[model samples]
Target: MLRVADIFGRFPQLETEQLILRKMRKDDARDLYEYASDPDVSRHTLWNAHRSLLDSQRFLEAVIEQYKSKEVTNWGIEHKADRKFIGTCGFVYWNPDHRRAEIGYALSKSYWNQGIMSEAAHAVMQFGFKKMLLNRLEARCNVENIGSERVMQKIGMTYEGTIREQLLIRGKFEDVKLYSILRSEVSLEC
Candidate 1:
């Protein structure tokens, strides 16, 4: 069992062939705003599309504080080729006693369907199992989000069924599909 501090003490930086999963910084505001402001990108997410760069900046400020406080926070997804912050991926919550955690992510629409998110998520799952010592890693997405569901499947998570009105997103309750994979079920090649 690991504590949040044990994992977030020094924000971990993960890398893949096409991405650098690192801490979100104040300087990433512009890049974050680029994608976060897109209605299409945020349509299925809990948060509304960012209205301005300030919205992105405010979000990063909170993430920075979370890092300082040794709390849970997201890894900024930086596309290696463009060196731009394209999205975020990380644990939404962790229950060490159960060795379980829920993962979440959001990506720029421009890079959708490119397998970039699947690659990034696979790395995060590997970290959860290998470093975080998680027995089970889970994720949920709005029922209508086929893209997110595909990412979960690509990373080898099994569909676990839908929860009706699981979340109140932007004033309306939305159903979500749950998915999970145990450490024992993971394939490194994923």
Candidate 2:
């Protein structure tokens, strides 16, 4: 039995060659805002581009609440080279009995094509399967999000199917592509 309390008791800090996946702090609002507020970043997602720092702050506050209860794991990706907080990745949802969880993430537009998200997501996937003992980890993204789909593929997740008009993003219904990787299928190498 996985206890949320136990998970929160010991904060999980994960690291990759060029990035660190850790808790999102209040101080991260500035960097978070830098990318999250960009129109390009939110274009394919359900949420709209943030208009101000307050929006990022409010989002951080909500994330902090989840951290307090350990209901979900969210990590802010930190680039060790420049010490810049680039983006975030983590388990957005989980089911203990089924040993399954849904992973989600976003990276700054400036950091795209750098394979940074793959590193961060790989670490998170390892934690979910090895530490959280998850049997299946899944990810979903807008069907038009090629970059996001690439990130999923880089982490060994296979494209399962597509959900038609599942997400009402911006003002229209958007199709979503689903991907998944079973515990036995996870490959930490690379």
Candidate 3:
């Protein structure tokens, strides 16, 4: 029997005033489906928004595999009030040579307007730049994703540039706005 603690050994369960950020698990699929199945939750995300329970299952499988392989740093975001998995927050594209990483996140709509994502971002960004020793952290969002942009800003990441038609999403070219925060700069903010 694999204890959840045995496989993970207690990842950093960061806490803010009202949220929790920690390692994700395969068992979270059922609780996560409540939000992961919503199109709105993944709309601005690079991955095509999940549309069904099966889609969420595939996602959960990938996340579980990622943990087992120690590939990327991904954290699940949960709201303390309800003890629910609202979304994920973490750095994905890690470049040790460049000392940089790419961050991505998604949260359920029910938790929007509550500033939970911003708190999660702050904690994760700190872990990446300071604890993980990353020199640069980047976040990109669809140009129309004002909410995501705001979260980046709240975490003190600087808006850097926009890549026109940088990605193809659902068969259409989409513009992406890039933001960056260097370890030196992030340290000042912290």
Candidate 4:
């Protein structure tokens, strides 16, 4: 059973000096299509390119439902300077017993190399450590995803290790490089 209250409780609106990180909406289908449907953005991720606008709509509906279910905390990233929706980023899987969670994100190609992900990550980490009381946060990137690895470094996370053939993405095992930032390691300015 899913409750709207629970879903609303999962994702809280967050603001950084340059961006607005907030919950997704039904009307965000156009924004969703920008990155979620792009092959370049989805290539490294586990999921494949969205097949159609209808598919993106369906996916957004399910994500919104999950928001209501408290199953995931997903955010729509918006740049304040431009007041435009650029992409999505948020905590994916939360593991309370382990005091950690997996962080995932995808940015439209237009936003790449602009330090947007790093800024969003800092805001998300603050939410995890302070509001969620999480002790650890992890970001696992495909071995070849140097740009993603750079975001982890920009956020002050430490390289954990590479897990060989850890994920079966698109039917082939792929190596994943894990990075983590602990509450103890986080700077107050973060």
Candidate 5:
């Protein structure tokens, strides 16, 4: 079994060929708002389109606070070329007793289809299984989110099943498709 203390004792930073996954800072609010405010970007997510910079700032503040606890871990995705915040990914739910976690991510529409999310998620999967000593890492996306489903598949997660009306997003109950990978299924080469 994984111990929360052992995993949260040190902050983890993940890197890919095109992106850096690190903790979000207050300074990233502007960049985060630029994309988070896009309705297209927020369409499939639970969060509504950000109306102003303050909205993004508030979100960042909450993410910052989560980092102070052992309950969650989030990383701001930074483009290596420009070092701009393009999105965020992290474990939204964790259970050390069960040795499992549920991951989530969002990317700027401008950066979509570039495989950045796949790379970032791949690294995160490694961290979850190896460093965190998690047996299972799972992800879920709205049934209509083909992009997110593709990312989950690219990361070697197997599609589990869709739960009907499993989530109430934007006041509507939405069906969510689940995917998961076990530590035994992933090579601990990270």
Candidate 6:
């Protein structure tokens, strides 16, 4: 029985060979703005491209508050070598009763096609199943988002199917491809 408080009492920090996944700070606004302001990075995401640094600051403010309230939030993905905030990855929704959760992520365009997102997603999925005791972990991406779909596949999630008009993004209904991986399907080891 996972409660928001139980899992988010303290935001967990995760790491990989090239990235550090942790709670975001105010100082990350510049880095967040750097990528989030790019239309290419926000094109496939539901959120609009940030118009200014204030937009990123406002977003961080909300996330910081969400952390205090133990609400669903994401981890800031920091590139180890650059020590820059390059993206975010975490559970966007969790269903304790069903032991299921949905993950979401976004990465800077410069970091794309380098397997950075796959490594980060793998860590988040492992946390969902092992720490949260989730029976099912799922992810969904716009049908046209090949990069996102590849991340899902790289992490071993099976594509279920495309749902017609599954999400309203940027004022338009968009079809989405759903993918999921069960606990039994994962090795559950580092």
In candidate 1, which residue pairs clash? none
Each candidate: what lDDT?
Answer: 0.93, 0.88, 0.80, 0.84, 0.89, 0.95
The Cα error of candidate 2 at residue 122, in Å, is 0.5
Q: Compared with the true structure, what per-residue lDDT tens digits does model 5 show for residues 25-99?
A: 999999999999999999999889999999999999998887777557678999999889999988888898888
Give the poorly placed runs of model 3, Cα more than 4 Å off: 1-11, 188-190
Error of 5 at 37 (Å): 0.2
Indicate the residue-level lDDT of 158 in model 2.
95
Clash count, one per candidate: 0, 0, 0, 2, 0, 0
Stronger candidate by lDDT (5 vs 6)? 6
Candidate 2: tens digits of C-alpha lDDT, residues 33-128:
999999999888766788999999998898888888767767889999989999989988888889999999888999999999998888889888
Pick out the ten consecutive residues of candidate 5 with the lowest summed lDDT.
1-10
Candidate 4 C-alpha error for residue 31, in Å: 1.6
Ranking by lDDT: 6, 1, 5, 2, 4, 3
The digit string of per-residue lDDT tens for model 4 on 132-162 reads 6678999999998988999999999999899
- Of models 2 and 5, which has the larger lDDT? 5
- The model with the greater TM-score, 2 or 4, is 2
Which regions of candidate 1 are displaced past 4 Å?
188-190
For model 1, how big is the CA root-mean-square deviation? 1.4
The TM-score of predicted model 1 comes to 0.97
TM-score per prediction, in order, is 0.97, 0.95, 0.88, 0.91, 0.95, 0.98
Clashing pairs in 6: none
For model 1, how does the per-residue alpha-carbon lDDT over 71-140 read when each residue is reduced to its tens digit?
Answer: 9868999999998999999989988899999999999999999999999999999998888888999999
Task: Judge candidate 2 at residue 84 and give its lDDT.
Answer: 92
Best by lDDT: 6
What's the best-to-worst order under TM-score? 6, 1, 5, 2, 4, 3
Across 1-190, the per-residue lDDT of candidate 3 in tens digits comes to 2233332344567777788887787777877788876778778766765567677788888877777766666789878898888898887677666677888888888888788889888888887765567788999999999999999999899999999999898888999999999877865335
